[model samples]
Target: MLATYPIAATEQNWISVTLLNALRLALESLIQGNAAPDFVDAISEEYRDAFVKGPKFQTLYEKFVAKCGILTSQQCAQILDALLDQNNFPAVFIATTTCSSIKDALPEVHEAAKDLFKHAFDKLSDWKSPGSEHTIRATYHQLVDAHLSHGSCPFCGYEPIEADDPDLADPDLDHYLAVSRYPFAGVNLRNLTAMGVNCNRSYKGAQDILLNEHNQRVDCFDPYGNEQVALSLSGTTILSGAGEGPAWTLTFDPDVKSQNWRRIFRLETRLKSSVLEKHYKTWLKQCISYAQKNNIDIRNMDGALEAVGKFKTTCEFETFPTIARLKTSFFDLIEAALNDPVGGERMHNFLVKAA
Candidate 1:
């Protein structure tokens, strides 16, 4: 989860624009197996000239993308806009060259089009100001700030809790980029708007490493190109699945679902059925019902109580709509439990411990 949304650099410097175009071209050629005439036509004379004359284009392009280095929003937006044009449908093929695995994951995407790339490139180029350096930095900062605010983790709206370890504290902005990248793929903002930062970053990354292209079982979930079909909420526990099946059922590449399952939900160990009181029967009943229907086992009383506590602290009181509703539901459960002690103890012993 992120504390803020990310802003995109909608504009770019001339050299950066040039680099993006070169990468798109190279990627397109690699994906399509051959460059389309439209793609050939889309290359700007200036960029084309640079590529022919500059020996370092490939190295520079790779470095920029690898670092998630800043780019102007104008450049990104233009690149995306042009890529989405019907004339540029072929640009998707270029993705294959950029990421070899893309060939199998998104085979249906169209090839990279020349006019669209050229237009996007042109749009970016035109935005260049008198001071290229200052303009680029300003544009980059604006987009980054926007993303930091609006693109927070959907589940918690909490940026990954900064790690104390310097090695881990480094932020992974690209993990959040899933929201933007998907939309950029086909100009589908609807997809972007609906994305959850947790699913996009946490789940996707884990899945990518866990599975290979064929989606077989592995030690981790490789999130690179996986989909999130179901998100299960049990008390404070959040379980995600690739679809309707068990976490282990949907195998493709890494054990993506399982890896995420471990990361998002922690086993509660402090619970004991004996601690049940008449304060949370209703909520307990609901949890039990949900588990029964879903064929989930909650025999571990500690786990159950821990789950209840998790709900109270994380899901119920949080600010998200999902957590907001959970907060209300939990209140009712607590009230019902209080009215009926045995059921309440079974349902919310965690509350008793806190009191």
Candidate 2:
């Protein structure tokens, strides 16, 4: 699941107004050698066409820097930051109802893209020339708008995705956000990352919601209050909840579970419920007869444990590696507990000690 952040066009407007005002003041001060008394009034005209405004903004910036003679890129960035900070401007978010595509009219919302270029020019960091800087910052804003425009959860309405599933056939930016936000998803950092095109508009986001231990939304857990959700692992299964009744279950599927069981727990997978009914019926009958002759019920602890354990160690536990090995180990443990009295006692004691 991914963590969602909120940004609004109203926030963007605030930032825009502040940046324009600062640009006016900086340019006026450079030209006249004093702050213009009507600088604030001049900034009131909102310029929405970024492609045109970009060049106009550059002309004004050059006039100022040429006059001042010593502004650096880092200094310009600081100035931009300081000017915006004075107005307490927030990060911008495009409204969900505003546009059909991310690229449409985005410059009108985020004029700071041009200013970021000014800062880049002052920094001389990577961009060797002005044209490159403009192109790069423009692209940055485009990516930002694209990211924002498609933010609503793919599955659920309004709310953003909490996480992405690897099973998704069309994972995109949404999926990346979903995985990046997972609390304990370190393993996925490398394996599950998808390109922007691959994850976009892929899965319905809401269906991916993971329940907290109480089976409620984990986000409901107060970050600073009594109710809190914690992340942990039950053997190899990812567990999320406070336990009495977990808010959600994130157990591996059957194959994963069985493979881990066989390798780690050393239980039998072949003699699984359905398998015994289909092909191992005669072998089970023979075991039952052996138990009867020994004056023990096949269902008894001693008889069952030995039979299950023998199948696990001899048949499935020794094969495979990686995920398959993990499944085999988990099953082997179950078989051991059911097959031998000593194995059951030892397993119980080990669990008790671990707890």
Candidate 3:
């Protein structure tokens, strides 16, 4: 859910040049209706530099041409156009199965295409220049620093457990489209997002988060979106605000796509961890202290509730986002407790004991 930079200029230039050249070669074969032998020869000659320098391209080109044999000229053109225009090669490959023969060839063609994309990224000599390396590394740290400063994993809203020396290594750069599957997107700027290492390596790992069962594209909740549904606790009883709840849940929204995103990332389980609960309890204790220090009369339940609500509302925007969501949700439970006569007395007694 974090913001990411646009593709670096050098990376974009390399992809455009390499993919456009590869597509042109394929188009030539398609137009001529070249058989296997002719197709191989044509590609070998046209992409002599890439084929000779990167032997893997020969295999990729062969697989791609084999797959293309099943496609009509219009279909080939459409795929190429989509790649050029939107940088969404996977969508085209996954969605269009007009030729039954293409079904068996799809997986091979996909891998070859990914290899080609990765090869192209490697060809950009300037891509890993010292300055470029510094920039990328710095960007990763900056993103993590910002998240830590804000108090949550931007992707799942969990508190990030940072190392004492976070600068010694960068947090993982999650490929929104797993690089293992979509090699072409390995260096695509929009494909990279900074996330907690666990979220990257443990939770997501090579899973294609971009498509649904019908192979249609599913838009993820944009980390950079202007607004988002916050996480909250549910099933909390009015008598005891913190005990015996039905675990945490996101404030429900009707956006199925966002829901799918949450499912893929397992955000609910991640955010409701014991560590987060500890943090939430600590914050609640602090709230109680603040109320007592400020002379909020606990017996005046309405005023106390209002005061607590106001404090949480203010802190919701001030602290890290994970904490903010936790605070708001917890505050809702506290407010409910204070509003009930029996619960209010219990809550007052609880706060008094804690104080």
Q: Which candidate number maximizes TM-score?
A: 3
lDDT of 2: 0.31
Residue pairs whose backbone atoms clash in candidate 3? 1-223, 150-320
Error of 3 at 98 (Å): 12
1 or 3, which is superior by TM-score? 3
List, residue by residue over 219-251, the lDDT tens digit for candidate 2.
211111222111111243211232321122123
Q: Give the alpha-carbon lDDT of every model.
A: 0.34, 0.31, 0.55
Runs with alpha carbons beyond 4 Å of true place in candidate 2: 1-192, 195-326, 339-355
Tell me the lDDT of candidate 3. 0.55
Candidate 3: tens digits of C-alpha lDDT, residues 1-355: 4322322322333333445465566765576665534433554343344444546656666666676678777766655543443345334323342212111335655565666666654454223323344343354445446535654466666546353253455456566766665454555545556677777887778776766646566655544333456455666443434565335555545356566666676776666664355566676677777777777765566657756776776666744566566667777787777777765777766655555
The candidates, ranked best first by lDDT, are: 3, 1, 2
Estimate TM-scores for all models. 0.34, 0.22, 0.66
lDDT by residue (1-355, candidate 1, tens digit) is 2122232343334443443455465444444444322322434665565444543433333432332223343433343343333222223222232221222333222122222222333333234444464333334434544444433333333223222232432233232212122322221211112234344454444333223456442332222223322222223311123222111121212234344333442111101111112223444465555545655444555545544444444334443333333344444444444445455454344443332
Stretches of candidate 1 off by over 4 Å are: 1-54, 58-141, 147-157, 161-170, 175-353
CA lDDT of 33 in candidate 2?
46
Stretches > 4 Å off in candidate 3 = 1-21, 28-86, 89-104, 119-152, 159-167, 211-219, 222-227, 233-247, 274-276, 295-303, 317-319, 341-343
Q: What is candidate 3's CA lDDT for residue 81?
A: 47
Top model number, lDDT: 3
